[model samples]
Target: MRRGIGLAAVLVIGCGGGSEPGGIVPLSEEPAYAVVLSDYTSTAIAMVRADGTAVDERWVTSGTETPGLVAALSGDVAIPSAGLGDGTLWLLDRFRTDVLTRIEVPSGEVLGQVRTHDAGEGESGWSSNPHDVALIADDLAWISRFEPNLDPAAPELERGNDLYAIDPSTMTRRGMRIGLSQYDVEVAGADGTSATAFARPSSIVRLGDVLVVGLARLTVAFDGAGPGAIAEVTIATGETRLIELEGLHDCARVVPAGERAIVGCAGFGDMAGKRATAGIAVVELVDGHVEITRTLRFGDDEQLPVASQGVVHVDADRVLAFEWGAFDPATPDRLFEIDLATGSAVEIASSAGPFELGSPLFDGAEDLALVPDASRGLRRFVRGEDGTWSEMDAIELATDLALPVRHIARL
Candidate 1:
């Protein structure tokens, strides 16, 4: 039930072997490729030749309407399907169409289907609002869950923010609660509520043995007027440490140069307000200790604050950041290259102009992929010699690919 792109949108992205001046340089050497899953309509998964030739298009899932997220590592692609309102969870084998498994986190059972429901309701159920998934080791799956916002304005019963370290071999759930504390609350708003009581964690990234979780601390409720920071939780011991900040959103990666972890804090005061003083925070993660070394802000501070929704740290020195024009998923996006050594940001590529870039795939310093809006499929990007970015062939994916891409890892 996947809809192919219309002739008009295809032409805008240079279909029929056409060319444009500001176009991404065509990919010269084909590499492994796949399409990001958007919800249950089974998007696309494909392999591309080094010179940008489409090798195949396969459907990874069969369910429609249920959005899924894809995470590919080694030789396996992990696809987690979102449940409706009954606490049911679905996991699909993206490479093989016949391989699919579903589980209920709360009940620990292999049911045909489970329902996803709001947290504050009468019946008890686990929220399948799966935001991100990562495969830390063979048999171990780390799933990040964003609890459903019952009150888009002001949620009364806030109970569900968690990270599960599941052993895929046993189907057992090893879970931990991920949250933050706000110390910067104004006196007028303070009411004996500790900062840790109402912290909302957004994303999580696992670097080796350390799991770095992004926390949006609340300075105020509903409005999301709060200080932002990243919490580093050790996977082995489960001990957590918080990196505090005034305004922040997402965190990036652990650079290997000084063995530092780079985080992107959304510096926007409100959804539409101007950028503030804080930018990307580079902290050193050694052994199991986390310390902030520098804060890269925009302008004289020579730092460009990273907009949330998309960010990738390829290495210590080079990082890929997505500058979101608006909070809307449909809003246009831009990619910036941040240099950690000098603490500066330079716009490298953009999807708003010629091609629309959705979730980006950063293979390394020279490789990246931009999933064009469902209309056009996935476009691969590989850095060229002249400080330019080029595109390869369109990605082929499973006809049943059912998830939006949460993150990408090259096999």
Candidate 2:
């Protein structure tokens, strides 16, 4: 029950300062052992085993599109294969997860790769639906293209998104509009009609050269609710800005704790009275802009109504959001346990949501946390030292057995 929506400041980009702590292994394949599921529609790419054990029934990178999200980088595993569904961005092999190599991102090059709506690169008007993939440096890589582009004549409205800068030593793709779908801008002031031109990029996080993206907007009038923003790109100088949030709207995951920014909103559920922005958005980046500070909701609108999905961060103040209830297993999916210093939040752990596919992956050893829960297939929680969180054994992947998942990484 807290919705600030403040900050339009702008002025803090002296040079950029906050992205320099690396530890996902980087190259000898230590992304926490292994657990990369993205059977978006199914084609293979399961690989469980860090304790969850599924042992590769078919890690087939991609051959029929639909791989969705995954980017564990180091010795491999960069799968973004959502070419809107035609799929293609796989880089696999993060320690024998099957061989796949493709990052030649070409079709329209970049404008959001508009092939035809979701594959937008040929006949369709807008598509840039890339969604998730990041490395920051170590050869450089970052991908996220899912924004604005709504125009069904007037379905609330949205028309923006595109941010790619992958070199992978030279796989290619340099298209950054910063955050990409700012539309006309002027949130809070409502000057731009009332807001809601939307800005939908979903997840991305980096602090040093700036980067910080995680958005999902809708505010002005739709009843279903919408409001979530944080787009601060400056990777070498794409120089963009936008920080407007309120409880958050659709974001899904934007990890990175020390410098702040742990959004995982998805709200938009129980709209009886209509005010669903969902929860969590603690952002940062002061002086120049970007400041949501804190939002974490669900104190009891009835509880168990969030939408979050796969977030990490676990230290600096804790984080582990993941509650993908949309597939509705009765619509409760848990695993919250936030604490950004003091904003509080509990739930501890619980997922088997029935379908949208639970999502959280950390397990760098010690504190542990890795779930893929499709009825409890690859779960594992273990925190305790003083902090708390339990529930360990889970491993039943026959290639997602029943299927329907669509994202989960940490190889």
Candidate 3:
């Protein structure tokens, strides 16, 4: 699914007032703020206040060096960590350009940019295809490289399928690289030949000192997927342990839900058969041990559909999830509010077209949620006083860039 964009440097476009051209200006002081929108090939940002007023739709626009405020991102898959709460955002230009771009959300300053993969001279270079990043400290962070390096002679640090520690301040590799090759499992291929299930680490979340990472565990050829697994890495000691979920497959998205964490497993197969194995796993972090508390299968006498993505926690007992509409083109993608306690789902919204809904971004402070719709721009949903969600005005994207709205993140 990798494709090249040929981005080489950071790009900035000034849209807000009080700044020079190609520079970013800080939005007005508010307790809550903006949303960064990306359509894969290009990007645009909207600065919105806590009261739902948009300060600027074109807060940042396309430029010569970069797509927008950050490097061009991959829309092949929606990245979970679109924005970080610490006044910063780390944008991953995966697929072709394995670059990670960091930006200060408040100031719109490009703090640092680095290519995560080793680009050796000529034919020797390989792309690591970074997926998600988790900030460990002011100077420390961990990023998951999704693709495995097939070359046995590759350097241990350059070898994919592991979490690499980096200095968030410098955007450079730091400390020891945490290898995940040991978690790989062997499985039967479609032709009855045995294949290696590479531990394709994707989404990661930091829970205190333990980092919970989701493993896709797909075959090297990317044609088949094995059971999903979660790796818990100790922050201080760098110790790692793999917890395999027996029936879950292609489980790649992880999100923190209050004191617990939820893992969304998109089981492999065609739409009809995939739902039988697809589900969500509820995990709990007790003391320092990671444990699976419950597993909710999507199609087992439930309303939840297969291929759940963009899982967002809505307190300890509830979460907002998106269901892919690939089973039928006429079936629009849906946004569901799931009750973890009851294993029930309520369809909150549906896209206008199949597979048009991207990741959903929730702002707890404002009791608001933003769902990126390719056909309708950014759809806003507000929580009522009685604790119910209702659709509000869609955020206007008044830019000339004709890219479809696919992903959104908060500033």
Candidate 4:
């Protein structure tokens, strides 16, 4: 049986007509929508029109004992379709907990939840660290687990570093598993313990019948990473192939860009080494084969200084990305409008401090982009009549929790 909690219904006026008790509520009558925001520990959702107007900030909140949506300890909001609208949402309660909670939008109801991994002895015994989900249909979905089990006697379902097929509606596994252990590399820990590094699958994006998964390939001790790779899994047959990027490490974010996909690779190692290996890879499916057509490397004199914390494709030739500035305290993180064709970038906005910005969400219909910042709230950027993007005033949540915005998904 599925586990869930019941919460009081909160009415949202003016967006659409009211629904009967326990019925599906229409979020909006138009294409205008809302975004669900997470702060690792909790979440808050808000509605915004196509014109960039904030409709409601407290449509749903994690302020009560049994909140409609919850992120246990350290977790994130996982929506199958980040750029597109989907009424379904998944909460990944990672860290010490290996649970995946399914939520219904508008109603803010917890439909059901499932433990993604097996529990051993104590609290820190084991965790699969479920990262991202790719929904193929109403009953079919795939979740990528980031941590690999070191125990040689672990069960197949308990093994991490792979994708597990599940039914989204029931929040249960469908008895099929796609393992990526073939991509593991050897590494040593700080205690000098040598073990095979995990593929550490993070983000997943669906392209036709194939699912493109990004592998972080971090060491056993989590202190370093190897050359990142992309695993292409055939949805119908469960066949898989790994494509390793020569210089990139920790390529964990993948976004759809027209016929191609943009991968954000945060390189590994010390400060200088991280910058040298960090870059972006533009990939596309050609003749049934996944190929990396272009790459934009950081650390070069002309390239961007650091790796990207978030990236969103604006068009076929351009992408909006924010740099990771934690390596250097003197440099604040900046959002850039990068030109893929020319290998050039234009600074559009900057954060107050390092590591404040999170993955961005863009609505082409609204021509609006949202970047979540820990200190600045939710930042908005709008494209003007002259085709130039400009920053607008940030949207502040009315909640008193003081949680930083970590992840966002369009409603």
User: Where does model 3 exceed 4 Å of error?
Assistant: 1-22, 25-36, 50-53, 61-83, 122-125, 327-329, 385-387
Candidate lDDT (C-alpha), each: 0.44, 0.49, 0.72, 0.70
Of the two candidates 1 and 2, the one with more favorable lDDT, higher being better, is: 2
Candidate 4 TM-score versus the reference: 0.85
lDDT of 4 by residue, 6-79 (tens): 43444232221122334434455332444555666555555566644556554544442233323332335454
Order the candidates by TM-score, highest first.
3, 4, 1, 2
Error of 1 at 65 (Å): 13
Candidate 2 segments exceeding 4 Å error: 1-44, 47-56, 60-83, 89-170, 173-212, 215-229, 232-239, 244-376, 379-395, 398-411
Tens-digit per-residue lDDT, 106-218, candidate 3: 66666666677667753155678889888777778788999888887887778889998777766766745889999888888778799998999998877777989999999
Count of clashing pairs, candidate 4: 0
Q: Tell me the lDDT of candidate 3.
A: 0.72
Better of 2 and 4 by lDDT: 4
TM-score of each model, paired residue for residue: 0.60, 0.30, 0.86, 0.85
Worst 10 residues of 4 by lDDT: 11-20
RMSD of 3: 4.9
Measured on C-alpha atoms, candidate 1 has an lDDT of 0.44
Task: List where candidate 1 sits over 4 angstroms from the true fold.
Answer: 1-34, 39-56, 62-128, 134-141, 148-158, 174-197, 218-222, 246-260, 270-274, 299-309, 326-331, 353-356, 365-375, 392-411
- Among all candidates shown, the one with the greatest TM-score: 3
Task: Name the top lDDT candidate.
Answer: 3
